[model samples]
Target: MPGRNDEDNKPVAVTTSLFMHPASSPHAKTVFWGMLATRPDRRGEKIALLLGAQAIVHMWEKEGARGFMTGVRQDNASSAALCNRLGISDTDWTYSVCIDPEMLGRKNLTK
Candidate 1:
């Protein structure tokens, strides 16, 4: 739904916990979920990248967060382009590992 917003048509705040690692740093930081939604009415890769960049800027302002970390499957060109626009260079290193397989299981245990 292009150009559609919730009743108010205003931007929604999106965030998620993401693991981080630097080449020289020994530890990682955990921030909230990164936003991944459309802007007002734009389309295609440009819009996606704009939204992605805006989300990071928003979080940094609101929560004092440092950076962002997001991933897309190998073939998700749109998302890949968006990430690229975020100025994320170098595909290196690893981050936190899921501790509980059940957390990612099919069943919605919390429900």
Candidate 2:
């Protein structure tokens, strides 16, 4: 354990209680990459989504991620739009049911 690789020792990053796993190898691929952001309050909807996109870009750059993967609920129009704006083309028709409480709040909806 004393001579383990840093990848095995690195800690995951979390923002607003949403966690992003540590990036160990650039060649290692990760799925389900997403940013958990709450809906805009004083700020406008567009600005909030812009911030989320910025965060995604930053994470991708910092982590050396090859590509991003996330899912928008069929009912979430804004999220779908945001993903499109971020260059995430929809290629699949699968649905995911998340259990995060913060993700369930209406305030968590994107623009």
lDDT, candidate 1, at 107: 38
Clashing pairs in 2: 39-107
State each candidate's clash count: 6, 1
Error of 1 at 75 (Å): 1.5
> Could you report the Cα RMSD, in angstroms, for every candidate shown?
7.4, 10.8
Report the CA-based lDDT of candidate 1 relative to the real structure.
Answer: 0.49
lDDT of 2 by residue, 1-111 (tens): 011112555422221212233557552554454454442333343544555565566556664556666766778876677678778778764645668777666544433
Instruction: Give the Cα-based TM-score of candidate 2 against the true structure.
Output: 0.52
Q: How does each model score on TM-score?
A: 0.49, 0.52
Residue pairs in collision within model 1: 15-33, 16-32, 16-33, 16-34, 17-32, 17-33
- What's the CA error at residue 7 for candidate 1, in Å? 8.6
Error of 1 at 50 (Å): 2.4
lDDT against the true structure, per candidate, is 0.49, 0.51
Looking at model 1, which ten-residue stretch has the lowest summed lDDT? 26-35
Task: Give the per-residue lDDT of model 1 (tens digit) for 1-111.
Answer: 122244686643232344354535534342433335554344443544545565566666765556556655566666566567676543664555465767666632110
Give the least accurate 10-residue stretch of model 2, judged by summed lDDT.
Answer: 11-20
